[model samples]
Target: MSNIGVVSSCSCIHPLVHLLRPSIQKKGLHTAARLAAKDYYEVLVLGGGTGGITMSARMKRKVGAGNVAVVEPSETHYYQPIWTLVGAGAKKLATSARPTARVIPRGVEWIKSRVQELNPDKSCVYLENDKKISYKYLIIALGISLHYEKIKGLPEGFNHPHIGSNYSVHTVEKTWRALQDFKEGNAVFTFPNTPVKCAGAPQKIMYLTEAYLRKTGKRSTANIIFNTALGGIFGVQKYAEALLEIIKARDINVNYKRNLVEVRADIQEAVFENLDKPGVTEVYKYDMLHVTPPMGPPAVLLNSPVSDAAGWVDVDKETLQHKKYHNVFGIGDCTNLPTSKTAAAIAAQSGVLDKTISLVMKNKLPTKKYDGYTSCPLVTGYSRVILAEFDYNAQPLETFPIDQSKERLTMYYMKADMMPFLYWNGLLKGYWGGPGPIRKLLHLGLK
Candidate 1:
């Protein structure tokens, strides 16, 4: 039977919701009996995020829609890249979200369940309640996890005003609130010590805040400071040089090797531990604080055979195929691909992964290689953006013929207006890959 039919008929699909009502628990008992029946699919995509949905759509064309199933528990799918603009009050938070149900490809089975364990050797996954779902081919795209709790007082400190994080769905809008309520004093932004989904996001908000404050005639009163754990502003040298010039011009203070450790929200103080010095910390009084919490691989990947020592899915950087398990593949923020984790990276990786899987199914080798192409639309202001596109070597692999390191209004429109439309229609539908073809066309007869 179709997974949808079972979901509609049985409350077992939502065990937590079923547990809420004693009356439903009685019905859930009988539903558990039916749930015990094992299910299998030709292709099982483990997440419903950008990579998972895109791959599932591609897989549906290769295999039938009914033969593919996705295991995801969320009710809403977010276009997370937009949160920068959303936090800056350039876009509404509502515009960045859509119903997950609406985006799941038609005729594909949506198994609304959280993955508990991945038994790759057994060619199956263990879902919640010990339900087993086997598959011929598996795609692991379970993205990274945000650890606000790792800090001294956060995930709860957010409850207090004068603090917000653009990294989270819950706390994103609070950033706008904090910015608006700012009268004067230190408006501090942070970047975590670990690998983040969008490395450019932390500083992106800082730039927007500077612009916002200037526009509101509060620039002189506000001391805009950025504390980051990274030694450099950006990985790419070309973009970093450009950004440094902007920082000098705008008079934004950037302190390197400083990591946020605590948020005393009540006292309006933020504490940072210098990575260079052990057990040494400094506290700054802030009128408003924007935190970029430490991030890492999801808990499910911990101790799993499919993961590396650091807990990210172990996959080949070129092919995105599992080094050990040929039948398994990975993409996006979940994999240790040595690239900046962004939706643009996923779009490029999806194209390469699609080819890799196709060739593997034919008992052949994958010829295509991913260049680690990722783009970050560094929103410098409400109207300006520096389109930073680069590859594995941190070299600029720009798409347009013009200089991309400089901030431009056209790029801002592309980031704010065009990217979301393409994400929903092109990337999700498996039709739009990266800008490889367009780049080739535009750069014709030129180096």
Candidate 2:
């Protein structure tokens, strides 16, 4: 457990509360100092994203209020899944965000700061503000780091009116703006060589743009291209088959094993290197360019002993517990879990971590397991979606009885309408699972 004196008997406020509210700095100075001397938490979460919020709520219910603490720096939290829709003009960017303070669990402490160091041996994390916080157990859900600089022209390319990306809440609306202005030429979308938070998002906007083009009578004038570094259209075989069919039927170009390496913004040109053919390079002109930047784990965990060489937290794929530290666990894009990173995957992971961490806190072996359940609602158009759900094996462990590989309006409505409600009201509020129960119920109790 944590150092016993960290829990105050008078106001019961944590040192982190003082970090935010300055009024407490004077009134609770002594109290804050006392807490600073110990600075311990029963359960400390390292992010305020979907997974961390879920953990805070779940832990509060299990261990009671004020026992959990979350270390995060952001004032606004984005429901990032909706960003694709935002770029598509189906959803507004404003609707994707909420204040972080308003959403964290009722009695949980919020430390608004970035982490600088992790000391697993002492169960402590060092913050950029020069404060040390200790925990009995730790959960990492810091998510993927977007390396926009790795790409040659990047944000500098924003000077070109047609260039935008859905990864940033600020820039995603620009994609819709660019599409709305397009008279036509080349509309290029690229998938990076690195693992991204939502693997399908790079192309989701492409389909939306294509649909917009068709609706606006510019489909015949614009050449839509999907240049992916991967050898295939998608990771899952079944979904890949369906997507390829859609591509051929739509006459969209697929340049497999092609990676975007540079953006010549002045000329409205993008450079692509052939992954399979190393020595060859091609430059293509674009009227509109959507780029997906290279992604990796956050720099805080880069050289830490808790992380793998690739900078992801090293955890058991099944249990999500740190390989070297039983009290340390991981969830979401930060973990080297060998699955597509998405909010939907985090939803499944939250369920497993809630059960496993409870057992670990009680000095019991965790019997709960995560099956690498993940879902990607692949939006093919303004009103069609191919709902891809699968497991660790990449097999089609679909939720609905109907062929989910096929594009349908119902799936689009689920993605566009139902998912945002579930995220805000259900998942972040500490529900035990994702769509598992509903999937099972729909399947007549079948696994």
Candidate 3:
């Protein structure tokens, strides 16, 4: 490995040149001699999102600070769970993001570069800047990538007045604006065929738009329609039952197995294809359209050997450890965990991975398990939410010892007021894992 410095002939001095000159002068132009003597960390985390941040902080506390390094490109950390609220006119998009430096664990080296290649066979990762990072253990927490381009005419027309998506912060506010400006005809919301981070987010915005329209006295002329690729309002039966009740009461038309294929923003038309029967297209003219575009793992991660066939980190469901490579672990939306990908799910997974990774590094089998706990604060109206919490078995795991499927004002307040603060101060800071302890305590250890 050569440590030679390359310089361009430009007159302007580069920032790195100024910084490195002091070290070069101290070492008498032989600084490259000390390159191989540096000690790398024991663990390397590839992202700084919810899972990566939580896992790194927990792991750093357990295995000392100098033993871990996080490779993340973004300087800002986003609380993506709040993007839904932002799109619903309940919160600002700015509130959903924070400086990554403030949230990452103390003493953890933050490499501000993307991982270009994963040489997992050699326990090293190549950076886009041509730097190689070696680690004794690796954790892949690179979150899902929103693929707006996957849908025809999507990226181009997404920011148009009547068309928007809640998946990205840049376009989420547009969704709320479109809803505010909607006066008549059909208000169409489409759920893509691909897996999304928050599966309920698509329809959540629809409910929010419905409430917004009603509030603005436009509900009479606007026909609220939910075109979902899935068969039901929710995967879990309990929550689905409640959602169905709301849909029927609101008189919202629900279309199943209908996926958005393209958006004709010029004419305010959205093209949909029936998933069950390909080539069967349905065009719906809309006054406003909220789209949840296709999402998947980051392209770099998908092309790496660490990814499974579905382009997600291939990990054991219970352990959160890689199937073949015991030293590698994964969490969050990027992992093939067979559960709904939500910040709540990532919080639960953080606890499981924090313990499992520590045991793996000690040459022991992981005893910790993740029961696939995930929660979605289903906001049906401005002051109502059904806090749907469940496990891998789809069994309801209510935290407050009450029926969480019913819409309640308290749940809505919790989602709006407390959850955001909890996410930033508690979860991202590696303080809150999940509602498991509270659930256990509330149920008197019966659950």
Candidate 4:
């Protein structure tokens, strides 16, 4: 029972009542303070990225506008997948961003605070300024983090000319500058050893660079090189074979099992360590360099009770629900889903998660399963893209009937133009849920 209930039920002598009055008032003040520090919502989403915003919008519809809240610090929400084109000078960076206020579903509370700690067991998250936000259900959409500093002479190396990374918003424009200023010699690109969002982005920029050099009549003088940590070009066998053919046709150098370890930006030198042979390293001088730095889970997830040993959110791969906590869920690049991290995957997962949450709310089992659908619009050139779509088993799950392995301008238009429109108008608004329905419709239910 509450203090008020005790006080109302009490029937004591005047002297006893007077003595107890002081203690009761003190207790009341303490309770008030605790209440003031805390806020509650029916649903609390923990990120402002693609997944978080999308889920929040969906949750607002299921619950009510006033019942949902989102905790995010960023003032600007970026359509990050477009950054690959932005870096290649195909799209402007400004077009890829929007004010967070504009994207967050109206009437849904935006906490505008960074998450300090997640106490799932307590059903609360601690934010900056000792603020406590409790929720009946929690959604973790905190995205992956890039570690450019992990590589020697880096984030700082980005300060130097002719070196840039598409992975970062700050340096994406610099990639365009470097490509435009390239005179001759080696134009090198790297794929890190760590799991990165859009695993194909590193090489996508390389292909654009090669195409750009050729268009500028500098291809004859420039030597395009791709130093990747992976043994193969791409994960899916069909797409890998297609990309290999493109590499050969472009006359690009492929140094497999090599990971960039350092950069000497002052002298334009890049160092790579052979992943197969631990300490064996190689150095190359470059006129232009694109570094895809190591990526990992966000810092707050490290040593967190809600995360796995790898620091990723521990969630069921099919339902996207917390493996241990029934009321907690995870989405996007933050979860250990054993699949490529891409916005397309999030779109598909969002639909399944929505169904799962709805069922859980009604005390029923989740029957809808996520097939780990993901896509990579491998931009092979300024006008061509190999649309690679697949599932968790690394099997091709193409949306179109035509060969997705072949580079096509139509796919490029979808990646560069149509997708952004869908993202802003459909996905973020909780309308788009990937190409699954369309795939089934096109295949006449036979696929």
TM-score of each: 0.92, 0.91, 0.90, 0.91
Evaluation by lDDT, superior candidate among 2 and 4: 4
The ten-residue window of minimal lDDT in model 1 covers: 5-14
lDDT of 4 at 437: 74
lDDT string, candidate 2, 1-447, tens digits: 001110000010011211121211111111111123348888888888877888888887887657778887787777888878888889998887887877777667787787889999989999876789989889988877777778788768876698888887657877888888889899999998888777888888988998999999999999999999999998999999999899998999999999999999999999999999997989999999998888878888899989999999999998899999999999888899998887777877888888898888889988988998887889999999898988899988777788989999978887877777667666667763666766787799988
Question: lDDT tens digits, residues 1-447, model 3?
Answer: 111001000000011111121211111111111112233668888887877877777877778766777777776677666667788788988876676777767676677777789888988888775778888888888888777787788788965798777777668789888877888999999998888877888888889888888888988998999999998889899999999999999999999999999888888899999988989999999999898887777877776798888788999999999998878888888888898888888877887888887787788889989999988888788899888888899888777778888899987777777777666556656766677776787799978
Each candidate: RMSD = 9.3, 8.6, 10.3, 14.6
Estimate, for each residue in 1-447, the C-alpha lDDT of model 1 and write its tens digit: 001100100000001111122221111111111222338998999888888988988998899877888888886788888889888899999997887777778767778788899999999999988889999999998988888889997767888998988777788899999999999999999998999877888999999999999999999999999999999999999999999999999999999999999988889899999999978998999998999888888889998999999999999999999999999999888899998888888888889999999999999999999998888888899999898888998899888899999999988888888777777767777876687777787799453
As a TM-score, model 1 comes out at: 0.92
- Pairs that collide, model 3: none
Least accurate stretch of 10 residues (summed lDDT) in model 4?
A: 1-10
Model 2 steric clash pairs:
none
Candidate 4 residue runs with Cα over 4 Å from true position:
1-38
lDDT of each: 0.82, 0.79, 0.77, 0.83
Clashing residue pairs for model 4? none
